[model samples]
Target: MNYFIFGGSGFIGTHLINYLKENKAGSKIYNLDIIENTHNGKSIFINCDVKSEINLNIPVSENDIIFNFAAIHVTPGHPDYDYFETNIKGAENITAFAEKFNVKKILFTSSIAPYGASEEMKMETTTPMPNTPYGISKLVAEKTHMIWQAKKNQQRQLTILRPGVVFGKGENGNFTRLYWSIKRHRFFYPGRKDTIKASIYVKELVRFMVFRIENKNIDIEIFNCTYEPAFTIEEISNSMMEITGMQRKIYKIPAGILKIAAGIIGAFGGKSIGIHPDRVKKLMISTNVSGKKMKTSGYNFHYTFDQALDDWFKDNNKEYLS
Candidate 1:
């Protein structure tokens, strides 16, 4: 079987490619991305962007699988139109290409942003109430994939994963920022410490993706990829300290003051400082998602939050602590 991964040069895609190479060896793998494939040339790279039509001259079979991870996901980083232009258009193009090739299985990596910034636990059954352009576009993209599956109900299979804050090697996201803040003794709670930040390890996410597609009995399944009883900001911070043996006094600042400060800093060309108003707002909100579905499906999570952090540190050659 052949694996076609769009956006395969990205953080999650890179990890997925590595996982497939180690586990599903001998399978033909093709990485279709606009960026260069730098994962030691494990998969065939195609210089293709998903925002436009996907044209592949290589041979493909109906039994082949397609993984779509293409999206402009960073909030406050891009203009509103950019998110829709890329994410929605990318989904449309990807599904169209799949239909053209008669590819029956598609696995999409969506985000928990569709649930909005809520402290309430979100499950697959929760109604999507997206608040941002990125969230709305992802929700629409999910529908695009669903529409494709519905056209060939019996023959097509679609698995949509809504993961929150996925962190691991090469992820220069929230976890990385937190690590740096604590290591530099500059970590602090923004507004409050009880805000839930549902997260998952990239390795576990890829494993679950494979497990769901291989063992699914339904035509389309939507699963929330996060730890059940999601960790609070304080809990996560404390865990990081314990795991890394790094201790620092964390102070809680009022959300309003931080927002004003971030605005002033951003207005005066403090972008490189990595303190934006939007990011500050994000810290104050909660993304309390649930992963009970994956657990009840008999899939075992190989890494706890702490273990995942430890593994990520090792993967980075322990440079995070250094």
Candidate 2:
């Protein structure tokens, strides 16, 4: 019942650590990451980089579960090589640790980017058509873990969750940025408002992971983890506006104009204006990945777009918004 979470300092990992501790799960939880996760005081912390050549120093048992959430995930943030180096190597090292330490299961939180930017509904069975370096690296990382699982005759369970834009209290990504924009009455619907942006609440994602782990089967299971019906940009913006009681004017900026603006701003290389060409391009595409597997597994998502926003606003106030 023990848990070892790699990349525990990041948003999703931080939430998972707190969830495990709050539930009073009667087992020690070890965190391995490049930086110390100070959010949870009870969990044991081990400063270890997954990309480093050195193996992790934490003790592991056959009953222990290793969750690999470590990766260079920010699409516009890292160089192409950095993505491959960190994600692929991180996977290799983590799986190697599992093999060496005889850990019973490895749960990896991969991104929906592996399926590439698609307007169509992408299921777990869909062939991965990764276009970006980050996408390709994640796909390779999945393969690397699968190879390790095969070494154990597929007896050691592997659960890979491909989550999309997971958001909650500490999130600083798209959701957080959008939240502030709406709060300030400055948010706009870029390009088409109908484009679906798949996402999950961080708490729900963590809960689903725990549910899967507790009822784990020996065979490998890959689930596309997000809310049942992915929210469109309009839906998200409307929810934000309604929840915050701010009826901000929704500007309809053209996609090409946004791209050019992002390009010009990104070229300067000064302090980030929070808009990059990659991020702009991402906004135009539909990340409508399907969560059929998780839904079919009989797990009910507790939050919709509006409910999640309400919970976030209630639980986290000025700090997260500002």
Candidate 3:
């Protein structure tokens, strides 16, 4: 079977492609993305933007699957309209392409951001109350894919995965920044240590996605992709310290003060200092999400939080020491 992956050059996409190459040896994988495929050269790379017409001459079969990982996902990074333009339009175009090719299955990577910041543990059945542009766009995108599935209810399969702060090798986002901060001895708890941050390793995420697709008995499945009983700030920091042997006396800084400092720095081009008002505000919020649906589905996780960190350290050539 062929695999058409949108945004396959990204961190998650690169890992997914590698996994498919290793597991599904004979399958032809086509990566369609605006960015160049710098990680996997063996996969067929086609320069295409999801927001525009996805015109490809490659052969596709009814059994082939489409994976949509394309989106402008970084928070506090892009204009509000950029999120809707890429995420919403990208979903429309991808489903259109799937319909055109008579593809039976599609796996879309949505975000837990659609659930918004809340101390309450968000479940798949919970009503989404997205506040940010990125969150709103992701929620809308989910509906767009659902609309496609509803049209061909019996014949088509759609799996929408709403993952939390995914981290692993090639993830230079939240976890990486935290690693660097702790390594440099500049890290400090912002106000409280109990702020919950729902996270999943990228490898585990792709593994679960594949598992759901291969073992699926239903036409549509929407699962929240996150580790159960999510980690708190203190627990995460302690784990990093133990795994890397980078023990340092953790400190607490007032969230109010940090917010003020971040605001001043942002106003005076302080992004180089690695603190922004939005980022500071994020520290105070909890993304408490529940992964009960995935767990109850009987898919055992391949890695625990600590194990994932160890593997990531190995993949990065043990850069945790540097």
Candidate 4:
């Protein structure tokens, strides 16, 4: 029942680690993060980079379950190459280690970004066309899993999970940004209120992982880690507004005008204005994910976006908003 988690202190991993601790599943838990995640000290912590050619620090046992959750998680500010090294090479290192160490199962957390499907409801059979470096790295890592897992020297079952935006207590990205924007009464609803933004609450992801560990009857395969019915962007936004008691002037800000503004700001180096052009690119598109396979794989849905926000969004808005 041993478990090893990479990037255990991050937004997604933090919640998962906490879930493991609360369960106290009678197994040793280990986390390998470069910065040393002592924020919560339940697990054995080792500060080491997954990109290192050799991971000689931690010991892996035959019954150990490894969850590869480490990654750069790209944003507008990152150098493109950094994403490949951190995401792809990192996964390779873990997969290689699992292969050599005779680990039983390796569950890798990839991103739905690799598929990069538009408004269409993407399925497991969708042809992935990754547009960004982060997306490419994840897809490349996923494409190579079958080879490593099938090696004659290994007894590992590789389970790859591609999840959408995961938010909960340590989230400092898009969710927080949007929450604060709405909290400040600066919320905007582009007239197209129907555009859904696919996402999963953090605890839902943890529940999925733990369930997989407990049920080893199924064959190892990739599953999309997300809620069954995706939440619309406006639905989520309105929830935030209602909970925070804030109201802002809502404007449609014409899509074409916003695109032009984004282009101008990007062309002139939006970094000075604290906006990375790539981040701007992220806002203009919609990413809706499907969890049919994951659902069929035995994970039941847990948190709706609003219900999830209510649990995590307490007074922390002060620190993040300021």
Better of 1 and 2 by TM-score: 1
Compose the digit string of candidate 1's lDDT tens values, residues 1-322.
Answer: 8899999999999999999999997898899998986878689999998999988899999988899999898777999999999999999999999999899899999999888877777989999999999999999999999999999999899999999889888888888888887777666687899999989999999999889888646499999998887899899889888877776888998778878988998899866656777888888888889988877978988998889989887887766732
| Model 2 clash tally, residue pairs | 0
Residue pairs with colliding backbones in model 2 are: none
**Residue-level lDDT tens digits of model 3 in 206-301:** 999888887645488999988888899899889988888786988999988878888998899977656778988898899899988887888999
Ordered list by TM-score, greatest first:
3, 1, 2, 4
TM-score of 1: 0.97
Which stretches of candidate 3 lie above 4 Å from their native place?
none
Better of 1 and 4 by lDDT: 1
- TM-score versus the correct structure, for each prediction: 0.97, 0.94, 0.97, 0.89
The whole-model lDDT of each prediction reads: 0.88, 0.83, 0.88, 0.73
Q: Where does candidate 3 clash, by residue pair?
A: none
Considering summed lDDT, which 10 consecutive residues are worst modelled in model 1?
A: 313-322
**Candidate 2, superposed: residue stretches over 4 Å from native:** 53-58, 268-271, 318-322
Ordering by lDDT? 3, 1, 2, 4
> How high a TM-score does candidate 3 get?
0.97
How well does candidate 3 score on lDDT at residue 136? 97
> Pairing residues by index, what is the TM-score of model 4?
0.89
